[model samples]
Target: MSSPTSSRAVPPSSPPSTQAQPAGLWPGLGLSAVAALIALGINHAVPTASALLVAIVMGVILTNVRPLPASTAPGLAVAGKRLLRIGIVLLGLQLSLGDILGLGWGMIGVVIAVVVGGLLVTEFVGRLLGVRPAQRSLIGAGFSICGAAAVAGVEGVIEDKHEEDVVTALALVVLFGTLMIPLVPLASTALGMDPRDSGLWAGLSIHEVAQVVAAAGIIGPSALKVGVIVKLARVLMLAPVMVWFGLQLRRRGGQVEGKRPPLVPLFVAGFLAAALLRTTGWLPASVLDPIKMLQTFLLAAAMFALGTGVTASRLKNVGGRPVVLAAVTTLAVAGIAWSGVMFIG
Candidate 1:
């Protein structure tokens, strides 16, 4: 009996992560700068256009390589997206909770009105369009509630929706939201809205915080505070609505064996944890800035991934139902947001 001789040859090259050096700081910063620059160019209505625009540019680069089918992509991208939502929520820390609470509470009635009204109106249109009820419900969650976060949360708990429907719902939220960034201010001025009222309306109505900032910035600084507070209040609604929609999706046969995941508010809890960390002075101001910067970096990376993910053909086929749902729902929400600000303030 003899020991077997070794046959394998060692490779000389470093592994991919090491060989590439993890994309480097400059590449990431360059990506962020490009996003910010593009957003700045398109930011007639808003501040964070950089996120989406940057993502699109990256997406163009990504698609050129012929991506793994989204089904085959690693689970981390999905998780990365959730982390971005948490980052957005935690940005609330830059404000005094007292001020946001003070202003935001008044908008609760309006928030409720917007959330409910938008959903019902959109559902009617989705129903008429013959979209599946469960799928339509997810779209309603986004428009009536918190945009992508709302859509993602409701989707987490509902197994019935086609991935296409989920993608389309998310697309409609971002697509219409980005469009509204510039146009909302123009409409606000055309309607001769008072600055405070317009800010409140823009904050309450716009889909993303970045978009709200852009919309309010177009009005003035006075509106920035009002609008950001309004949007943060709206963001808070992601939890309860996600839970309710989760139950509805289950009732509607959306629940399958091990299909439902926890709702989006769980991530909100992580957001609150970060805020509590800040308030407790557990995180120093010096550290806080970096942590926020980290979150922004993470968000930018994810946005780049999102932009890379979509194909123009896919975007074109996102369906008429969700777009119409978004418009009608926006109208319903805006009207209620106005009424709520008027009544509460």
Candidate 2:
């Protein structure tokens, strides 16, 4: 648990050379932006595959086919960390405290139960299956919360070198999230649940926000509204979960080399503040619309940046274990969420 920087103490008598580091981030940022643009275009045309998924696939393709330049590493890091955090903060604008509270205590309890239960069960199964601890946490977060965003949030706090695990978890999320778009509706119909309950099920179980929207939309407009609000309820859990993980990391002496993140990260704080601002009715639609656009673009770009971290060799090293873990985790979450929906209704 020693700090990463402790071993390589530099002597103060001979300061390091003042050569300025090259501004290499532009290339990576530019590439990520391009990927995001391509994803947006694809989403517009197809309307099934989410832009976030498209961007991640593009990043993986680029990395495997033609290796990105070394100079782009700095920028890619920026996109993965800073841009991801900023995107998460802006995400708050899409939610409001009033809307979440309106769901009533019974519905809120169901959401909390599913999320907490999903995280615990997934992580336990992961451990039993021999997955690494950090990877297990990332996978659990992805399944229990808001897909790639949740994985990114957990990774930021843990500060581990398991970037491949994050990508693996995200890949699984995209896969099942996509599949659920069709599967959920079928299940809802089979169960004979009304549109409202179906929407709640989708919101609780689906991994990504876009995937929830797509699934709920297929049911009906009423379903879509219920699904989105429920999904936001899951999203709201991200902050406290992140703080708990951060505290766990600190307690276990897992702190990274430098300054540790705040107990409640700055991004989470910004997210709460933005949500409160939205509740105030002060944010005009014109401003909110653009912010929403920017939020999506930023998250897309961040996904692409994370994708660049996944090379063929690394995937080969991981083999199929992560995928299996993802599949099991996804099914567990879907079932648990559905059970909650049934019990509540």
Candidate 3:
């Protein structure tokens, strides 16, 4: 099978050494993520919504100060992605038929319809807003399903190298979305939706699961749990959607279009298989817990890979198109997510 590629490209030799000793994975990044947790207090940060905010801000700042190149083994990147997907599946442990049963059949239809509908609307908006192809791909994927990672996964197959445009775009979406985590709950309460529907809207609409859970927890734990289940239903679509898009790129001559490409990711397949296992009930909780534990490790490793690759030189002014594209597309997502929540909730 053909492999996926990254947006970041590497040089033949080394570019001028920005630092005397450039650690492959920034030496203190773990410390910094930990420090962020400590400073914010575990009550609020860590993997919660606020943690993503801290991570992205720190990541961008680190990018400007010491842009680590994410030149890791192609194998590691592939393994990292699959592990993340499995972790997502383990998230299923938190759900069962009970939550959906409580919400009733109508909520289920609403959730399903909105996710399916939103994907089409977001894609059209991205294309119309003239988001760069890669940025368009990222924004569309990020909004439609999981953010950051989803964009990275699909882009892994579609693009040949990690151009600044892609990273810059991902950073902005993550940055802006992270910053917006607080507002979602406010909007939810203001709309006067009940906790059941409120949580569904939160999970279905929020870009990241961490964001959904955080916002819902602030509103209430029941909301948090229900929202997570809603989010997973959306996550399930990543593989089929990516496969469809990947076929288009391969048809377009894809990375062979010319460039020193990175390896294509095979995790999408793993993700699909895991989902199938979940559907078939082949993996019991006995095994799922270990998988979840493994995912936690992978999430940290992938973040490390993503962090080392970040650099401010590319994120610099970067002209205006990418930023403009992200802003417009994000606003576009907000419109869709909000309207869906209102009508469906």
Candidate 4:
């Protein structure tokens, strides 16, 4: 028998084998980075446009236009999963308990009610529409919480194969949320809503933060301020909602390769910690500004990676049930928020 040292000798081809794993990540990462940069440039030119939305659209376009090289898969996977988590953790830094509490008890109650109510109504309507459970939950999370980011967060905890569902949810948010940007402002004006109420409605009803901001901006300066604050409040619910989803999955015996998902994912815990840190007012604008930029870039890159998974054929196969469910959920959320604004006023 050979000696232990000889038996453990490195193979002649081991060096390239070891290097290949990391090397494979560069192409896809580079592609995602490029797409994100283009998205940023477009958003900068059209301030009202959402960079995240543009990134995902570009990704889908590229995917349909041509096939990506196999080498890009590793980096794309990193962008979609690891980078996405890091971006979400950093997202917490944008929120502060102090700011949310400043809205006072009445408006706070309305915000909570909107989120909870929207989720329940969406799930109920989705079931009635014959939407798949996974898609229904994803749509509910996206519409009820913070839009595409919320969908991505819920997608992380779900062990089921639901990539198409995630994409569909994101697409729905973009579609309905975009429509709300113009419609909410016009409706607010026609309804004789004060700037504050208009802001509240936009913040409460709109799906994406960017969409809320656009709608609020169209109303007035005061509307912009209140709208952003209210939207952030909704974002604050993401951590708990993600944990709840994970717990639900565990209760149903959802597992990945025989392993149960953690009750609170590490990234989500990090998100909570980041928010707490923000609450302390320790990080100044000097630090926050760069972190904010980095967070946006990472999230945009992740969105691009996710978009690549979408294709014309897959989208065509998705059918119209999800579209109908999205429309109903959008109406449900807008109605609930509108009523809350009226009641609180």
What C-alpha RMSD separates each model from the true structure? 8.8, 5.5, 6.7, 7.3
Lowest-lDDT window of 10 residues in candidate 3?
A: 11-20
Cα-based TM-score, every candidate: 0.73, 0.91, 0.72, 0.92
TM-score pick, better of 3 and 4 = 4
The alpha-carbon lDDT assigned to residue 19 of candidate 2 equals 35
Show model 1 residue runs off by greater than 4 Å. 1-48, 64-72, 75-96, 249-265, 275-284
Question: Which model scores highest in lDDT?
Answer: 4
Best-fitting candidate, measured by TM-score? 4
Q: Please report, in order, the local distance difference test score of every candidate based on alpha carbons.
A: 0.60, 0.80, 0.56, 0.83
Ten-residue stretch with the least lDDT total in model 2? 8-17
- The TM-score that candidate 2 achieves is 0.91
Query: Best to worst by TM-score, what's the order?
Result: 4, 2, 1, 3
lDDT of 4 by residue, 1-345 (tens): 112133221111011122347766788789989999998889889989888989988987887788566566667767877788899999999999999999988988888888888889878888888888889888988998899888888887776545578778877888899999999999998999999999999999999888898999999999999999999999988888888888988999887435789989999999999999999999999999999888989989988887877767767889999999988888888888899899884
Runs of candidate 2 with Cα error greater than 4 angstroms are 1-22
Q: Which regions of candidate 4 fall more than 4 Å away from where they truly are?
A: 1-20
Residue 12 CA error for candidate 4 (Å)?
Answer: 34
| 230: Cα error in model 2, Å | 0.4
Per-residue alpha-carbon lDDT of candidate 3 for residues 1-345, written as tens digits (9 for 90 to 100): 111133332311112123324343233334433534432454243546344334445545654565334443232333234434454444444344444456566656665565555556556665776655666666667766777657656655666444554456457657656655777678777877788767777777777767777777877878887788877766666666777776777677666225423332356655655555565666687987776545544443444334433566656746666566655555555666556666665
